[model samples]
Target: MSFLDFLASQFSKLQKATLVESFQDDLDSSVTFEVVDRKIPFLPLFDVRRLEFQRGSSYSYSAIYLNKHLRLQPIYFAVQRLTESFFPKLSSLGSALVLGCAGCSIPRFLALSSKDCKITGVEYSETMIKIAKKYFIDDPIYHYFLLLHDDAFSYVHKTTEQFQLIYVDLFLADNNCPQITSMDFVNSISSLMAGDSIAIFNSLCLSKEDCMKFASRYASSFTATYVFDHQFHYYVVFAKTSSLSTLKAFEKRAMNFVRLDERFIAP
Candidate 1:
């Protein structure tokens, strides 16, 4: 590696170590983490009794932040990486929907990247939405952002509006992505998408076989499907408009963004 690259790597390692040490000290305390937004203190009230960051293959960091000091570490890194890589296309669409938006990370990223796009996020957890609005959502830049506190399934079944992009990431406690993998859910999502719309499903299942099963089921409803594997049990399922040319265009946009921002790297 070049000298500058090596230096940056070392600095990143140091920062991670420091953060871990601080997290350990605050594990027993009710600590609030804040993100800077125009010098405003937007703190997420989490009793983060436990926090762990694991380094997986492909230079990824998987973080597990527990509420009751539990040591339950779920699949986090791969999903985050995949979302960052595919976010350009997901955000550039005219209208989008994000189901199971915990803390609204993907929605915030989308809003920041494509200010003109309309984003509707459905989240069951009111507390999570509150935290997301405070820390993640930028009201000024994202005038078209709408957050709904409701069940994902109910929202998809009721909403008559069509979307150009749809993202789903549903999981229960202890990293278990329930068998909400029903055909009805797939049909509901498909009916709500536009002609060239795309749907992305994030799963914590590591096996390619399992991921393909999910993709195939989704493909049964949509026009086409593909899976982006980000090692460590994180899989991104893309449905509809599976043209190779379209995918290549999306990848080119993602690569360009990666070149501009070092924090964004695809698996």
Candidate 2:
């Protein structure tokens, strides 16, 4: 069968299997409470607060709340793709920062992918941070991960620290992008980077126009920008310089990503 046909068939089977129903049930069944230090419960569905979980030693999910309506599907897909494709290339970076780290999911993935790199995560909600720390403990990957409860925009504006990789995934809701995309905010983030820094921005509402808008905003501050779409999500990569070395690094990293995971290839 053709690839599209196969995808459709698989999707049909998934729907029939009641994937949404199963997740909803899991969310409903998961116990909710408070814990001290490192033992916390995972909430897979919408509740008064965001959900947090620690899977084995590396993977985890932290969010403000679950969507019984299943709005986070795209975010999960984008995070998975980024973890598989972008994390491997960041081994050499000494430091990294994740903006709008809801449940610290991306930070956990970064920790697992490169245990030696130091990671600092900035989050706006204290409740979310409390849930994340309580549920997501310090594993080998998390040993180098630090969670800071603060507004992402304020953190970027006030901090002068430079990192090799900067990741932004803040959002208003399931479908809305945050106001941090303004030119001033983008410029502030750009100023926090070193000579060879790379910034990755995640946009949930994916469309050609959305991609162009992000690219245009990023272009105002950065010397180079590239946009890619996968599984209905838009990703924009910005760089300080359009050097041959930088381009080569991106190509090498992308190729290595494709080699490591078949899902990394553009669909």
Candidate 3:
């Protein structure tokens, strides 16, 4: 390793981490779920709680957040940063749907960020839903969120209710859920959207080329489509309206939400 790489690795080892919980779901023994709490090395005042799922040699983090203190709020996770900046402009919207409710982070964030946006989160794992309730969805704001234990694919295909905003974040241990890239899933999501609506997709696991290709394949279904790069992560957005005034407004407001100094954004 180079000098900087060596230093970075050593510095990472300094953080104190505790494995608070671990379990292998009976439904899927291939993956193990864990919840961890780790203190920032130099900044002892802050701690991060993370929920991770591991399969064989690969792993995926479902949620990460600094321990909440009085009035101090830190938005560090890239997905949360994107959500914080992206959702407010759509405050007039009444409902949102989350395809994969890992750790309930997005659901909780959406509820807190937009009071009127009733959030519905669907997760396949029963244990995951229990864990989310026990660990993440404790705040009063979550009253606006209705978390269901069901396969996102089946739920999407069956739910007749439409949403003004939809967030697709399905993943399994660093691997993209097979259905997320499928045409059926795409069509189902399109049908679930309101006439004037937007969908945000998390494509962090896909390469830039693959993300672009995937976005392009689905572009014809939406009036406006955009692929955005933020802090080395990529997100694809689709809107039903011909005009992109809301998206443009988000660009200006995003500066306030994504400035480097406000949050420690390193993964």
Candidate 4:
């Protein structure tokens, strides 16, 4: 199938699955979620909060947000760790883009971590964007955010602006969007990145073999790549240039994240 066709098919299927149902599938602990807010869409922009029983703290996800602080999920902690570690001085960064914009967590975190950083989220779901603005982002636009709307690919194609940080965390329901695995899409996205930018991808897979296959394709699109695996998921970070120096800077901060995210790192 063509790229747009594939995305449409997956997106249609995801819309059939409610956001609450998707989160339910992801968190299968019989825990109940207290509804915070919701918007009826093809996929309901349902926001709910629950106590992570194991962790003994409340967490939330609505199509996106995973914590009150809107932090990256533990599964995606490395993406944040690497971003933090690589930057050294976070405020030096200028802008960030979050593809998929699930609850706008990355943008939220970036705002807190860097005052100068402007964050733009590209989300296909207008309902999701509305939910985010009302619930998570809650920020006055034209100043902090360019806003989170539009087809991600179209936005990538038209925007002349480049970003220091780009997050590729698109998902439809519980499935990873098929288009994200393509090298063509990766290359198109790379064109919108700054010279020293980093792109992090969240890949969902049924097994390690699947992760490896996708990682190989993504690795070819960047100068250097790092893969972190957990269960059936693989997260990859690709550096556009200064591969060695970039990894070295990231290594200096490795110890900072090793303890917290180590358990999920598959052997």
Every model's TM-score: 0.63, 0.64, 0.77, 0.67
What TM-score does candidate 1 get on C-alpha atoms? 0.63
Tens digits of per-residue lDDT, candidate 2, 201-228, equal 7765556576666776556566666665
- lDDT, candidate 4, equals 0.59
Candidate 1: residue pairs that collide: none
Best by TM-score, which number?
A: 3
Identify the leading candidate in terms of lDDT.
3
Score residue 31 of candidate 2 by CA lDDT: 27
Residue-wise C-alpha lDDT for candidate 3, range 1-267, written one tens digit per residue: 235334534565666879889878656788888887776577544555668776766344554444433111222244555554555564555899988886876675566566778899998878888788787787776557888889999999889999988888887656678678789988999999887677778877777677677777777787656566666566776667544675565556655544321111111
Ranking by TM-score: 3, 4, 2, 1
Show model 1 residue runs off by greater than 4 Å: 1-10, 16-92, 242-244, 247-267
Ranking by lDDT: 3, 4, 2, 1
Which residue segments of model 3 deviate by more than 4 Å?
1-15, 40-45, 55-60, 64-78, 84-87, 90-93, 251-267
Per-candidate count of clashing residue pairs (backbone under 3 Å):
0, 2, 0, 0
lDDT per residue as tens, model 4, 1-267: 334334434554333222322222223344333324332244322222211211234444332333334333222555677687767788677888888874665676677677668888888865555555555566542257766578787787788889888888776555577878676678777887898887777765435556556556556566656665543346666666655666666656744653222211112
- Output the TM-score of candidate 4: 0.67
Model 3 score (lDDT) = 0.68
Clashing pairs in 3: none
